[model samples]
Target: MNLHPRIAADTLPVCITPDAHVRLMNDNRWPWLLLIPLQEHIEELHDLTHEQRDRFMADVNQVSRVLQRFTQCKSVNVAMLGNVVSQLHCHVVARDDNDPNWPGTVWGFGTAVPYEPGQADELLATVRKSFK
Candidate 1:
């Protein structure tokens, strides 16, 4: 299935995996990445073949490594909840106790602060470099 245009390469601030479709978090302060499986009718992990599932898990790990290196986060939270979009996407969130939304869940806390142009560029570069 086609992904949201906003999640596409050109629109995303970072391009970690050249061929793999990746989306950088719009929340500037939080080091986050969203990985959407490039498959149609995939509402859950079970929807994917065994091989595809393995690849997806590996991709998640790769993204975690990137977040760990760049953000130096105190902890990493990975979740896949299809309640909202139902598109079978995974979220890799880098969290720290010092973060504004930290010590609490990132969801439903408050509005996300969009990244500044320069900050976004730097983060984009860092994430892209992490993949290499």
Candidate 2:
């Protein structure tokens, strides 16, 4: 599937495969990923075929486990809110009480803080290694 222009514009490419596009959110406040299935015209989960659904869950689990392992987050939040971007995407966010939006939604709470040089390098490297 062709990635939505808005998604390509918003995130930095991390790792991608035939079935999924993995990207790191520009905001570094909390470790996050936007996972999009590479299936044509799949605007929602129900739109996917049974095989696609199975593969999609595997992809989600991949990202979720990686985030939990590296971040050691108190909890990991997985959400698929397609309100603004009609494209079906899952947000795998690592969170702790220390995060800015603790006990609340991370959206609209504050401006996103971009990742620093070293932090970005380390994160991308670790994630890439895990996927390999």
Candidate 3:
């Protein structure tokens, strides 16, 4: 329950486990996934304890693998930028060279193209299925 203020507004909920909250980036242009650890008052990865860090990384890997498998993305990008949200979270982006922001960063590149209702639901379902 230690989510940051901006996450709810900027992202759509996908699922919540003991260690992290999995969310869709709300951008359909790219398959951007987020893993926000449920640890309270943490703004950086280093703030996590050793065990917590391990579990967090595991969650990140799980999401990254599923993203690659499902999206057939050329490359997967992972990052944790706290400047805006200030929460301890990881972004797992599925990128292709042809993308508008190709060979560069996805942040602040342009306005987000959100997922259609069915697309979003299907994506969420795929991710949840992968976990099981």
Candidate 4:
């Protein structure tokens, strides 16, 4: 399935799982990942079939663990809000008190800081390796 334009614009492809397309948000302020389900026209979690939902949850759990392990952050935030982008996607964000947003949510907090050259590449490589 094709990704929503907004998601495609804001994220870089990381890896493809059986049920979702994993992408890394471009912002370097935090370690964020997006898991977009491959099912067409799915706007919410309830829209997924039981099997699909199970697979999607597996993807979320795996990605969340990978993000936590890679960043060793204070916490991992997982959310599925479709207010701006209606696509069925999950956000796995690594949060630490030292991060810019800190105690606040990353949404609409500030402009994203793009990853420097090779920075995103290194992260993508690390995350991909963990999935193996």
Q: Which candidate gets the maximum TM-score versus the true structure?
A: 4
Each model's TM-score? 0.84, 0.93, 0.94, 0.96
- Residue 128, model 3: lDDT of 85
Query: How does candidate 2 score on lDDT?
Result: 0.85
For candidate 1, lDDT tens digit of each residue in 1-132?
A: 487554443235455353345677777667778888877768798988998888888888888887887778999999988776767878888999999887887776777677667776766676676677
Better of 1 and 2 by lDDT: 2
Candidates 2 and 4 compared by lDDT, better number:
4
Clashing residue pairs in candidate 3, if any? none
TM-score of 1: 0.84
Q: Between which residue pairs do clashes occur in model 2?
A: none
Residue 73 displacement in candidate 1 (angstroms)? 0.8
Pick out the ten consecutive residues of candidate 2 with the lowest summed lDDT: 115-124
Residue 44 displacement in candidate 3 (angstroms)? 0.9
The digit string of per-residue lDDT tens for model 4 on 1-132 reads 899999999999999878899999999999999999999999999999999999999989988898888888999999999999999999999999999989899999889998888887877997788667
lDDT values for all models: 0.74, 0.85, 0.87, 0.92
Where is the poorest 10-residue window by lDDT in model 3? Answer: 1-10
Of 2 and 4, which scores higher on TM-score? 4
Q: Say which prediction, candidate 1 or candidate 2, comes out ahead on TM-score.
A: 2
Off by over 4 Å in 4: none
